[model samples]
Target: MFTLGTYQVHFLTFWCFLKVKRKDRWRNGSKKKFQSQVDRETEFLDVQESDQKLNFKLKGPEGEIQQGTCRYLIGAGGAHSAVRKSLGLKFEGGDYNNEFMLGDVHVKSPQRMKGLHAFFTKEGILAFFPFDDSGNFRVIYGDFKNFDAAKKDLTLEELQFKVDQVGPKGIVLSDPSWLSRFRIHHRMAPCFQMGSIFLAGDAAHIHSPIGGQGMNTGIQDALSLCFKIYLNLRRGAPFELLKGYEQERLPIAKDVLRATDLATQFALSNSLSTRMVKKWLLPFLIEHTPLQKKMAETISQLAISRRDQKIRSNLKIQYP
Candidate 1:
């Protein structure tokens, strides 16, 4: 009946934090009742799906392998999802032209790094996001900087050197707490549903960190899918009710990918990238662009499918 596959797939995810944050509106003691249902500090080792149900193999904090099962599976495991691999779905996208570096460290500069700042230098495009008044900030740069650096251990001296490569010169960086080189791109799974199992969050889609929408989108995926699951699983709704999970959420994921793909072009751009970024959004990409943190705004303004007008109810699920 479901179009996903004979073996629909999903990995394990602990929704404790996302759940606790929304527990305020839960009626009565159900929150406490369900609180015990969450598995904290547990990691999934493997999964086996059979006859429209999923069996989980997990490692506990003490390193014991525990087993479990459920009527449904929602894959939220993220980019390297073992669940997705089990489903045999293609991620279907490629990396941007140049490799990138992102790090949060101490920055010293006369320029106010209070908000997102994009600087276009002769070498490439560089941006700064101030983490706090303590001079700690996140720096991002791209433009063929990929080399042995990708292989050798990254060092503070090397990070500063690359910062120099993208020169506007007044800034000094140090106290590197975290630094890593990676490639950004636009990617998505063609299918988000596979029969009794479904995919949500980063397991369903991923894109550039251009507007800080990765986690938000994944949260959206979870909330959207959860309600449908409740309706069918608890409310005794039609077996067909599950079909709407992918129909409703998949298009929204596609919209996010399209929006971020365009934005990533600027993120990875060297020449017109700077000017284009400034042309559309002077200092930041959030307030102006169509990449709305809430899909309600994205649908209304960004021309996402009209079906997406259904406002995302807060994590509150008033199950009937």
Candidate 2:
């Protein structure tokens, strides 16, 4: 992996493959790519929305111009969504000032990195996620004191220097496969839909990677939308039936945005008081059973409550 611009975040320039989270786990082969994963090669030039249909213009893989029209548009195209921009939509959010870095490597230690492991330090926050039992890990670190750290051409040695300061003891990161420098944000679009065109995923909202909520929330956004679209198209439902998409999803997005922004600030805070809170308060809170249960429910989306999507039960897609 190479460097990616701050706006271009999360699975932006990779092999365009990842997993969707289910009740059990998030694991899938390269062939089972997320429907929303857009390989970096594609570019959106412009999008135009209308009463009858939406017109889209884009640059394809081969540097050729392309244009098309569709009756419905769902913008799952990440933060810089073409469809959202075409409609003059506001992606309303602010960026976290701390410069951050991430990469995949193997941690040389016997400790099982089977799940998320966060190391809160005086410098910033270092998080490790295990890929498998072979010690492979995805490491994310925020540099609170070193804002001037190189933004591009990030090296494993640079990462090692920082990891040695903040990472788990006796665990050495090695055989680095990918490294990247990026900034994160806490923001959401003001609305999810306008007319027949709609926005979902990062197109509608984006937040810090603190809770690992980006893809899971976006997938849920698509889920809230897909059946609604089916009802409108296949079951002769009213277009107004689709407005429930925003009603159902906007609150969830708003809540996620608020929660993540707060957590990120708390995690990456440079203030001495906040660092003390992390050092003292957070560890105790982490061990709280109710808090753990709430975090689990929120991560799995079981705690999400829709406002106006009860219509889903009455509406079903009759496959022809």
Q: How close is every model to the real structure, measured as TM-score?
A: 0.70, 0.81
Model 1 over residues 68-167: C-alpha lDDT tens digits?
Answer: 9988877777898777878889998777656667777789878655544666554556776666567876787765444343366666777788777664
**For candidate 2, what is the lDDT?**
0.73
Residue 180, model 1: lDDT of: 77
After TM-score superposition, the amount by which residue 29's alpha carbon in candidate 1 deviates from its true location, in angstroms, is 18
Candidate 2 per-residue lDDT, tens place, 1-320, comes to 11111111122111122222332243334325554454458787777766687788879899998898888888877998887887788888788778888878878865545555677666677877766666777888987754454556778888888877777556788887778888887778888888877899998998998767888799888877887787778777788878988988889889888888888887777676876676567667766777777776776677776654456555633322
Candidate 2 stretches with Cα past 4 Å from truth are 1-42, 61-63, 110-114, 146-150, 307-309, 316-320
The local distance difference test score of model 1 is 0.65
Local error of candidate 2 at residue 22 (angstroms): 14
Question: Residue 119 error for model 2, in Å?
Answer: 2.2
Model 1: residue 149 alpha-carbon error in angstroms: 7.3
Cα deviation of 265 in candidate 1 (Å)?
2.4
Q: TM-score of the candidate numbered 1?
A: 0.70
Question: Candidate 1, which segments miss by more than 4 Å at Cα?
Answer: 1-48, 59-66, 145-150, 236-239, 271-320
**lDDT, candidate 1, residue 47?**
71
